[model samples]
Target: MLRRALTNQITRQQFRFYRVNRSNTVINFVPQQEAWVVERFGKFHCVLDPGISVLFPIVDKIAYAHNLKEVAQDIPSQTAVTMDNVTVSMDGVLFYRVVDPYKASYGVENYGYAMQQLAQTTMRAEIGHLPLDRIFSERAQLNAKIVQVINDSTVKAWGIESLRYEILEKGDIHLPQSVMQAMQGQATAERKKRASILESEGERQGAINLAQGQRESIILKSEAEKMEQINKAVGEAEAIKAKATAVAQSIQMISEAIKHENAQKAISLLVADKYMDAFSNLAQKGTTLMLPTSVHDPSSMIAQAINIFDTLTTKRKDMKSIEASNEDKKPEPEK
Candidate 1:
């Protein structure tokens, strides 16, 4: 009985040691940005976070180990028809991360594969809604829409959070040869049209500037001519006024000289000399002269001139007396 009792005690000790070793074997040192999904007795259990974690040797099992870091999945190239009925083949990348390990492990067969397929389908659907031109121009908006669609479909169902979607650049989309040629032609025509418009605008502006310059020049020239004409008119008027003043002064001096007796004798002798000189010039010209029948008498001609001068003086005195009488006959202002 004592030997049997001792044998049982040793078996119990051996069982305890095996359990310790088995538990040690199941211990996990999880790294950062990782999660381990645990199951107990083939049922869902708690998730093992980063750092040291222990599990029941037989009851607990690491069902799925998920990396919490973001993942970039390449979408396979596929052809899709656009709204305008043009076909284009395209490929891109999808960025995602596992947020809930529990759902990621059980929600879908494979979350990464599901995300890739969803992204591709979403891209094709979006392409179908847009024309070929819009597809190329609206890539950013297309990517954002794709990301939104993907997250909406997979966030709650697959525990996958789509960070973003990006269509690769550098000719990722392949068009038909005919489409490529057509697009090239269209681009060339657009550039030519813009160049022609710009050229025409430049010529129009240049013509306007030239016209303005010519107009200004003509206006300035006319203004200068007008000023010259005004200056000439003013100078001519001043000259006429000066000539009138000089003539008036000479006439007054002549009248004063004729008022003296000696001056009258000197004027009569000057007239006789002028009459002889005139006859001498006529003889030199070899022209016939008509005389008053007293042609040889210088005294007769001087006396005739003196008599004409006295007659003109007598007429002037008579005119002044008549003017004075008319002035006295006019009515005066009332006192």
Candidate 2:
């Protein structure tokens, strides 16, 4: 083998060596440093950081040794979930810091592709359980749930966490406006029925309360009237008792005074006035004083009549006697 001056590659000199001589010199290359994989930078090439440097440059065919840890950077934190086997394309961003460098590097062939496959599979499983309505309407919420599910299994082995998600495609629940109107009508009918029931209950309760109030008013009024009647009766009884006591006292005083002749004579003068009043009342009522023909004396007739009237109307005579006693209190004529 012929080697160039600077590079380890075979130059045109090696070609000329092969053309001139079929078999001339046998040569082998002895590298000074370990081989490493390199990617182009602005002006220089830098090795990718992982558990160790990967894709070391070698002399044979160019072999790109991929570290799962370095490639997993493209895997986003957000995962996409398809609804009921529906296709969806979405983009997301992930924030990740390598925790287990060794596992990220050597756990899988391509960590990004593995994570994407895992996310896709998890999305399918999660969205398969939901209907089109939920998948389209609650896409973000379902994505979070699916992300959590995926995280449970992946984060431990893959050293990645699902941060957030976005949905790019959707399916339709496809409810018609006529169906919505029907639902609204049902709700309105239910509300109206409830309102009617409540109003009827209120009216019934109001009537009951009004009736109870009227009954109470009537009872109170009756009680008040009874109390008033009782008070009036008590007042009348007290007045009557007082008047009887006064009359009894006056009669007792007159009886004591009548022990003497002078008192009797004074009492007789009172009787004369009482006789005049009685005659006046008898005349007004068309009553006649009938003199006894056997007695033939006006005074005797009066005394007989008084005795007879007292026997016939005892209560009336009792009042007349009280009136006569009261007349005794008036001034008499000259002695």
Candidate 3:
């Protein structure tokens, strides 16, 4: 009976030990932007998200931990041959992010290394298709092509998205010394050619503008001269018209005065006075003078002058009577 009691005590101790072990629990604290992959019996069971996660201690295991963040990878310098058979060394950077944790874990052994190799190979292949000059000029297009090719192969299978690829700046692309020297000379020549063309164009435009200015100046000067001549002609014509009007008014006044009875006597006295004035000034104006024989006889000279004036008046009256007779003889219109 004592042996049976000892056995029962041992069995109670064993039950207590099993119950204590069964009460134990496993808790995991997951950080932000992280994914913990759980495997049950060597197979994927579930993914634990950020926060508290409980797992069975013996059966559930965290197989892989993945950081769900964007990453940038630097590409190492490598030599590539262009289609024109020129060799160049270049380097760049790549940007990417993990979209699916499970696929990233299981799709490839090492996605980062895989991506690097793919980028290098793609870059070389693209460079091979272009000439050296075009390779530099079309760098943006080359980067886009590389990204497209990488994403095409990795997006679904590897759960990695390639955001962009950028080739490094100036010093990243290295050419041989001889090639660089030749390129520099070519660039210098091209710049000189452009400068010369611009200079010639400027000279041509300046010459054209100068010619146009001269033409305009000539046209203005000719117009001004023509206007001057026209103004002078108009002034001369106006002077002649005014002089003719004054002469006509004076002649009309003289003709009316002559109709008075004492007009002839007044005219004789005016002729005598004009004769005396002309004879006195002739000695001061000139050394030589031809005087008529009757110059010493003032009365005789006045009588001669009056006779000539009366003869001219009689002829003027006869001409006016002839003009009136001619006007009367003209044929009238058959009104």
List the candidates' TM-scores in order.
Answer: 0.60, 0.39, 0.67
Q: After superposition, how far is residue 103 of candidate 3 from its true place, in Å?
A: 2.3
Cα lDDT tens digits for candidate 2, 205-318: 999999999999999999999999999999999999999999999999988887766664466556655775776687688755763374446677556555654465467668
* CA shift of 94, model 1, Å: 1.0
Q: Write the per-residue lDDT of candidate 3 for residues 164-197, one digit (tens) a residue.
A: 9999885789899999999999999999999999
- Give a tens-digit lDDT track for model 1, residues 19-121: 1111224778877988877888989988889999877787887777788888888887889999999999999999999888888888886566567768989
lDDT for model 1: 0.83
lDDT of 2: 0.53
Least well predicted 10-residue stretch by lDDT in candidate 2? 17-26
Q: Relative to the true structure, how large is the alpha-carbon lDDT of every model?
A: 0.83, 0.53, 0.83
lDDT of 2 at 116: 59
C-alpha lDDT of residue 22 in model 1: 16
Better of 1 and 2 by lDDT: 1
Ranking by TM-score: 3, 1, 2
Off by over 4 Å in 1: 1-24, 215-335
Query: Which model, 2 or 3, shows the larger TM-score?
Result: 3
